[model samples]
Target: MTPHRLGIVGLGVISAAYLETLAACSTLVVTAIADLDPDRAAAVARTLPAAHPMTVAELLASDDVDTVLNLTTPAAHVEIALGAINRGKPVYGEKPLAVTLSEGRSILAAATQAGVRVGSAPDTVLGTGIQTARAAIDDGLIGRPVAASAVMVTAGHELWHPHPDFYYREGGGPLFDMGPYYITALVHLLGPIRSVTGASSRPQDHRVIRTGPRAGESIPVSVDTHVTGVLEHVNGALSTITMSFDSTATVASPIEVHGTEGTLVVGDPNTFDGPTSLRRVNDVGFHLLDPLAGYVDGARGIGLLDQIRAPRRGIARANGELALHVLDVMESLQRAASQGRRVETSTDADRPDPVPLTPRSEWLAVQH
Candidate 1:
């Protein structure tokens, strides 16, 4: 089988992880690379024998490209995705889908009309850490999930990120930036959210960059720094979520799902694999569970690989429908925070099928 061709539209910090993961993939090849910075694109392209540096438009129009990987920032997600769809190319993008719910809808709608697939990130949820927890819940180890808690706290990305300006912009708040991982994992472990009630605050209007060449430079913060919300899942399960950039630190499990029988502590959903621990209703303490599901030694590009392979089997686990729903949950939560009322979601998505334990070697060897 011929390898699927991919055109990457951005070369940001996160692009390295995807490139590293795709480098060893036999089923996918990066054919074209583009970025606002031509030198960056050229630098990245030179590393891949099959890839050529091109303008965004040129990459989108390239005959060598079979699909477009939208790695642009949150603000550019919709533009790049829609462009790909309009050109009849499938697109797999980084998370948040778009800056606004309506923009997100437009991308999906365009993809539908163009008859192309749309996939999105936060694929971290498809890893062993979250998948193992999902397997437990499905096996009744958690006997009907009742509630969940997701917590992510930090002083701010400005402390480490070289270009942290986007982390505090319109599409870049604690809730929007980091919420996708937690909320997507919640949907995977529990189910789709029905409604949400939230409260948020922006205690600081400016953040100082503590690292990189921009060290000590202050950037304006236009979005909330602390966000807390309650998500009501369709199954009547409630999930409490806190995403904060104002806090110093936290020792809490990234996520904890409670049920009548036990509580599952899920590891960080931001990575491909993290530890998952469980403690039954009457258990003495939480015990670590070995990796029982998801792509073994998984990495960033696996979701795009999963999407590529979906045509041969079931739906893509990290698909656009799920991403759109997650975006809805997030936008709704923001609305709830600003309105001081419960905001019912207008979208829904089925829980993607659980991934059975499979090694990277096995998955990479399969023909799509």
Candidate 2:
């Protein structure tokens, strides 16, 4: 099979992981690269013999590029995606789809009109960790899920990220930056979100960098740092979510789902493989379940491969519709917080088909 040619835009921190993962996959090939900084793009190109650096405009117009990978920051997601769509190229991007739901909708609309595929991240859900939990739910092991809790807590990214300014801006925040992973996992385990009610806070106006050379420098926080919400799933399950940049620690499981017959502890949705445990009504404690679904030892670009496989199948698990729904759930949550009312979500997506356990060796051979 001829590998799908991918042109990558943006060489930020997240791009490194995608490059690493794509390097090992025979299903996709990185043929071109671009970044705002020419030097950075050249540096990335130097590492891949088949890839050459180009201006963002040049990369978008390259004949060898079949798909554009938008790894740009949240604010640039929509612009870059629109560029790719106008050029008639399929797009697979990093999460949040775009900074806002309106922008996200525009991207989808353009792609639909252009008749090209669209996919997005939080592909971690397509990994063993969350997929295994999803399998358990589908198998009736949990027996009618009732509610779920997802908690993610941290002091702030300014402490570690060298350039954390974007994190506090409109597109960035605890809710948008980290919410995709948890919410996407919930959608997989339960289903599409129907409505949301939320409350948010920004306890501090300014944050000081702790690491990096700019340590002690203050950055203004324009968006809420802490967000708590309840997402009503279409399946009638209610999921309570807490995403914070205000706290330092949390002992709660990353995610836990309760059902009539049992409780399930899902592993961190940000990771490919972790522990997924379950406890029945009569069980003394949660017991780890065997890995039952998803790509074992998976990595970031697995979603891109899924996209490559979609034409022969259908929509990839990490698809544009799912990303749009996740975005709708989040945007509604933000509005709910500001308006102090429950907001009905405008979009819905089907729970993607479960991935049967695909070991690394087998999944990698999907190139054919």
Candidate 3:
């Protein structure tokens, strides 16, 4: 098989993780890389013997590139993706798809017209952790899932991220930044969301950066920092979610699903493997479940891999439809919070097919 030639846009902190994963995969090859700061791109290119630094425009137009890996920031997602799609190259991007649902729709529409595919991140669901939990639910281990609760809390990204101003910006709140993981996992396990009721708060106007060269710097907060919502799934299951940058600690499980017969403590959706546990009716304690589905020890770039292996983008597990649906859920939740009313979602997605457990060697191997 011919390897998919990859042209990466944006060489930020998150790009480092993707590069590390790409180094181990065989299905794709990094032929070119680009960043707003050409020096940064060049620095990264030096580490990959075959990849060369180029301007963003040059990377988009390169004949050698079959795909564009968009690791740009939230605000730049749509613009970069449109550039790649217009050039007839398939594009995959980091989470939120775009800052707004309308922008995400535009990106998808443009890709459709250009005859190119689009994929989005938070592929962690493809990892064994959540996938195992999904397998359990599908196997009826939980026996009719009724409700779930997801919690994610921290002091704030400013505490450790070198440049976290974006975390508090319009598209960077706790919900938009972190909700995708929890919400996506929920959708995978239960089904698409039909509506949402939300409440939100921003405790401070500014935050002080506490790490790296930007330590002690103050950044303004323009979006809600603590967001709580209830997702009413189409399957009639309910999911309560709390994503906060205001709290320093919590003893709550990252996620838990309660059903008619049992309850499951789902592992972190941000990870690839799990120590997933379950407690049946009258059980004394939660018992660990073995890895049963998804890529073993998966990493950040698996969604792109799924896209590359697909015969058509629509069938890819992390296709644009799922990302667009996720974006719509988040935007509706935020609007519900701001308007003091429950909001109905305008989009929905069929649960992507479950992944059979893939051996570590196969998942990491480049198809030749």
| Candidate 3 wrongly placed segments (more than 4 Å) | 312-314, 366-368
Per-candidate count of clashing residue pairs (backbone under 3 Å): 0, 0, 3
- Relative to the unseen true structure, what is the C-alpha lDDT of residue 350 in candidate 3, on a scale of 0 to 100? 90
Q: RMSD, each candidate, Å? A: 1.0, 1.0, 1.3
lDDT of each: 0.92, 0.92, 0.91
> What are the per-residue Cα lDDT tens digits for candidate 2 across 84-193?
99999999999989999999999999999999989999899989999999889888988999999999999999988988999999888999999999999999999999
Ranking by lDDT: 2, 1, 3
Residue-level lDDT tens digits of model 1 in 326-367: 999988988999999999999999999899998889767635
lDDT of 3 by residue, 172-223 (tens): 9889999999999998899899999999999999999999999999889999
Q: Which stretches of candidate 1 lie over 4 Å from their true place?
A: none
Model 2: residue 298 alpha-carbon error in angstroms? 0.9
